[model samples]
Target: MSMSRTWPVWARTMVSRGIYSRPRTSQERLRRAVEGKTVLITGASQGIGRATASRLAAAGAQVVLTARNESNLRELEEEIRAAGGEAAAYPVDLSQPELIDEMVDKVLAKHAKVDILVNNAGHSIRRSIDLCYDRYHDFHRMTAVNYLGPVKLTLRLLPVMRAAGAGKIVNVSTFAIRTPPFPRWGGYHASKAAFDVWLRAIGPEIRADGVRICSVYMGMVDTAMTAHTPSLHRLPTLTVADAAGIVCDGAAGNRRALGPWWCAPLEAGSVFVGRPLDAVFSRLYQRSSDTDAARRAIL
Candidate 1:
């Protein structure tokens, strides 16, 4: 059985109510929102993006899958098509800005307009400041994939969405950014937070143009992205399917923000008790041991 399935009833209940509750959207609702729409999903080769693509396509959307893994994207494309869904795969590394532009152009050339854009691609790293002293590339790569890439893609597609007078942009952001900052996650947090703030800042400006934006402040999930962090494995996490469902909810629902029930409280705490929270997090960080990956990298 899965780790989530093995959890005690109370433990599961707390997770569902507090940390990361999956949003349940009816198939009929999803179909009504995205049917016949051209939706583009980044990082669609695996994990949440992959699952989201499958779900959206099943709802009658023309799904466009993009990621660095060409083989995986092609395989998913075939799988979607075999299931009687419309899907097209375009493999492009999000870290490459030029490639993103080219891919967007190609997609526009084919589909003319993308009615929904899911900015789901991301790169995550957890390393202490001391460990990163000699690894500036870590910050660079994180910003490249998590921040700049999404911004570029959004800019390219926003004009078309505005011109069409109707569109939705779903940003699959992390819940960590809304809470007190955690140690050893500076680079990752900063990069993701950049895009989060960017999207929210422009949301009002574009709302009048018939473009809507939803930011899903997602919690930990069981995916290749988190597979390397063994400590995270012990925590309650959403399955890829659960995460996908939440993304679909953001796609179909009118909510501006979707996240755990505890998110707002945590955000308030971060603002009111920033210093105390920092001290507590510092103590926790001091007690924690480095991961095997961190040790390997330092060596």
Candidate 2:
């Protein structure tokens, strides 16, 4: 089952179900999620980013958020703070390679330590490789933000997390990297795949340090990033709030791989049935009504 569907609806919506709506007078219950801990989230101004920030705030974490737009970040910061959740906004263009380390340093210096880091900033392109000719830099730009920048930032932050004796990390990835792969998403898909590879390879070593890492393989959500894509593409897609809940909950408790998870079963089945079997199944699945409509149309 997908991460979003892995449990009963009550478990998934437990955080939002007026269960905590009564507002607590005691600091004990309100303190578990965030209370005093510091959290850093990239792309915190909108969509999954904004939703994630809101989720963390609801949980009580002091959040440090950054993105390309200063105004948007400030606005989101205000909204979160208004809710009695501590938040700070930092503006950084993640595509600009130099800024990643600088941003990491800025957060490190001010916070002394970051308890959790969520790499959620990424851009997606719906253009074909042909259009990307001489536009290989397009791939570079996406990779710089989606793969390298996040990797570099995570690397720079690792020592502090390790020394602190515990930490959590979440990488926001798209489900497009899986079956019915979008036709023009070669660069975006490949870049995200690269980051997933890098994280999984070193995951064990980090786990050895008591630091947990998870890759959130997300499906379509209503975000500005996916605005151009057809609505049908988002079939069964979670809302941004729903998506953020998965990431926040996973990061909050050290769960591995928050996901929309349409891909997991295929991969699991592929293991026993083999890649060829999976490929045939994918072709058949693509022809089925249950296949994600948007992916099929685009691909």
Candidate 3:
């Protein structure tokens, strides 16, 4: 059974409400901000991306959904249209750079301009470094999907957005990037950090052109992506709807960054006591066993 299903209703509700704060953007606010805009969302077939697409389409945005799952994308497109919302589905494997280019070209050809771009698709792995020595493909695949794919997609759409003189690029990043690095997540963290830093570095140059960027540092959410890791089952998690709301907040707001309330303090603490945090994590690693998913993979 999935981790979330095992939890009692009250426990799940309490954990969701207490640990994961609610998103501030309301349906009315989202409608006011996005009505009549064309928003292209990556990974729109499932999880947070799927929920975000539905919410935006309901708010009057013409949503273009893209993901590897063709059937799911088409189903979502039809569902949105049935609900009286505009939607289009373009399925492509984001890990491939050429495919990303082709997908972007087609989208532009059809819509002329994409006003908002949501980089929400991602892949996650939690194997230890020892297990990864013979599995270098792990890092390569992670970088391909988590870093290069988004970069390629963004680069293609950025020129168009800049030419239009007003655009929003919301990157759905992880809150783990804000905290001290944890064991077994080095590859995932590094790949995500690469894109986060790359975007921020170029933000100043793009701001003058009216291309605004916001990084929504998301916390762990109950989704297919996290389902395999049994270690995370008991931990607090945001629901897909909650996460979608936060992403919409990133889309409608002017803030350069948004995350859980504790992200800032954790980031600050990491900066001030990096060594101590490292030591603590190291000890935790010593006491912990490999995640169930990792163990099954090894067998």
CA lDDT of each candidate? 0.91, 0.72, 0.90
Model 1 pairs in collision: none
Give candidate 1 regions above 4 Å deviation.
1-14
Instruction: Please give, for residues 1-299, the per-residue lDDT of candidate 3 as tens digits.
Output: 76676888677766775665568899999999999999999999999999999999999999999999999999999999999999999999989999998898899999999999999999888888887788888889889988999999989999999999999999999989988888988989999998999989889999999999999988889898888777787787887888999999999999999887888887777778999888999998988878777866642
- Greater TM-score among 1 and 2 belongs to 1
Expressed as tens digits, the lDDT of each residue in 1-299 for candidate 1 is 55665798577656754668766799899999999999999999999999999999999999999999999999999999999999999999999999999999999999999999999999888777887888999899899989999999999999999999999999999999988878988899999999999999999999999999999999888888887677777788887888999999999999999998788987877778998988999899999866888767732
Off by over 4 Å in 2: 1-31, 178-180, 231-234, 270-299
TM-score of each: 0.95, 0.79, 0.95
lDDT score, residue 178, model 2? Answer: 50
lDDT of 2: 0.72
lDDT score at residue 276, model 2, on the 0-100 scale: 68
Residue-by-residue lDDT tens digits, candidate 2, 174-273: 7656544444567789899999889888889888787889887776665777655553342334556667766766675555765543467765665666
lDDT of 3 at 82: 100
Instruction: Report clashes for each candidate as comma-separated counts.
Output: 0, 3, 0
